[model samples]
Target: MTETVKLKNITIVLNQPRYPENIGAAVRAMRNMGIDRLIVVDPRDYDLEKIRKMATHGCLDTVAAIQRQTDLKAALESFHYVIGTTARLGGQRRTGKPDATAEKIVSISQENQVAVVFGREDRGLSNEELRLCHELVHIPTAEFSSLNLAQAVMIMCYELFNACVPSKPAFTPRMAQRRELDAMLDQLRDILIRISYINPENPDYWMHHLRQFFTRIQARAREVSIIRGLIRQVDWYAEKRYRDGRRDERNRIMGKGAAECD
Candidate 1:
């Protein structure tokens, strides 16, 4: 039987994996879930024999097809949306923002070329590396949150595998892409600055909150277009009113000077 074509578009990336065995086992997990693309970033020099020995079953083909990259950023360059798997928060992550779950990850994967990054075996992802991701995900564990690298890959794949079955009611809105959303936000930032909604001295602070609020809302592309159009309208009206007010003030002054002459 031919392999199922589920999750055909999702690319799995392993970053700085230390063990050949884990790589081998990850192939099996991927093959089991019909995930064909595997990207490895700066992995240790591993013996293919060691990898093959650990990759039991008919998963050798998956092992053979692994793509190598010098760094995680290079590996993920093509994917528009990336999800980083980490239990701990790092860098400039907003405080107390909950992680996107497996379901949430799968939800975005429907329309986007999603790349899910698994960090190094020893320390997980560095804060700088995590910044590359659009979101972070964690598998909920009771006592021990740290899952084995292969185990983590398996869990994510399994969840994706189960969740990716053809959608039933089919009324889901097309989610806005990062590029599109970022463009709208850019326009919004300019309008906000024009209106003085953003503090001139600390624009980043105001924008940071607005970004968080909109990111939380997860608005659709159509929805974001509406918001952007509204901002344009507000700017248009504000300028018009300012011009009209200036004209009326000039007329009043001219009339007062005529009365004084009389």
Candidate 2:
């Protein structure tokens, strides 16, 4: 008997959703697809009664268990992997198909908490929010690409459900959580700025590429620690060299003064 994907480890995050009905319907869709965890961040309008009406009594448990947050970063801090759903694609908004993305999610879900984030109904995830995601899933459509919030959730959830198969054994360990990665990135940014590797005025521009590289590798906790350690060593060495140079200059100046006095 093959093991199935860990659906319990998967969470659906709705970012700045505007309608309670859509939230309720999204809850129903999640329940149908066997994904129970739901997190709502900075909702524009949230009414329990209105949500429950659309979710129906059958999905009361899911609606009741929904977690609410005021910040997207805080909501995603504990998750090891995050996938953002988007319809528009260009430039930095590169995306993967739902099926392929689902496979990757299934593998990562084995040992990490995974989150699938959806943006507001009017406009999808902003560039800043999308930056938080390790990957993006785009549901293909005709030239007309607009999709309802609930509909997009249902489709992604269905793909995840369908891909719940025993993935091939790989080194998919408990990867570093979002918070850990963010901390490392912050440290790295400061060090890079000190060394003039990245522009202080626009450090994030270069840091974004480094973040993408780390995300692509699915860095583990130990790996992140090692990177941080390397960064600290670099910082220490740079400081030490500067101090040594200053000391040598002072000695040279003092020696010249003594020679003149003699």
Candidate 3:
């Protein structure tokens, strides 16, 4: 059958937003949609007088509790997947990958924490920042497709708010949290290093790819535990084999044998 992940599961992340008015309006858009979390990355200092004035009534708490991060990547760490808004289409789109619509975003949220990222008013999301996103969405518009920052936020928020209804799917498993997923990734990375599958000095080579791999799948909490258990077993075997191999070589070199035989 179908499941439902409500609008509460959604988050709005603004990257380097320059305008206090736009930020205030974004708060209203999110509040209107029943989405509460607001994460702003490297925001410029704006006068509270202007911001609160634009925020209107009942939105001050959101402005106060709003999270601030140094950059987009840091802001995105806790999310299972990022839906970055971008108008530019080059580096990432070189493979001809198209942007996702809001419906697809909702569908993916069935078992993942979805962060909808809007870039700065001047440049939109940088190409480097866009790479961190699991997918991108470009709101369709007439000629002069560039939309105002608040307008972009409003449209994306509207879609997610509405999509939480009958269209939402039914998911039985409790989804894995950010820290739990990171734990599994760390465990697997350690095992891979023990087995010579990955380099210890540069762990992120495969770790980054692994993160990308996991983001696509709607892996549940139980699934993450299962994978960690499996990795532990593999680690045990790899270490046991490697020790035996070392002992065998030493025995061959000397006229002696291993103290503990395999």
Which candidate leads the pack in lDDT? Answer: 2
Write model 1 residue lDDT over 15-95, tens digit each, in one string: 999998988888878878778788888998667887887877587777788888997766775665667888675455642
Best by TM-score: 2
lDDT of 3 by residue, 88-200 (tens): 76543422112335556555566567788988898887766765666677776777776889888888887776553353354434456655676788898888887788889
Clashing pairs in 3: 2-170, 3-169, 3-170, 4-169
lDDT of each: 0.73, 0.91, 0.74
Summed backbone clashes in each candidate are 0, 0, 4
TM-score of each: 0.62, 0.95, 0.73
RMSD (Cα, Å) for all candidates, in order, is 6.5, 1.4, 5.1
Error of model 2, residue 53, in angstroms:
0.9
Quick one: how many clashes does candidate 3 have? 4
Superposed Cα deviation of residue 77, candidate 2 (Å): 0.8
- For model 1 the TM-score comes to 0.62
Candidate 3 ranges with C-alpha deviation above 4 Å = 1-5, 71-81, 90-101, 104-113, 126-132, 164-168, 186-210, 256-262
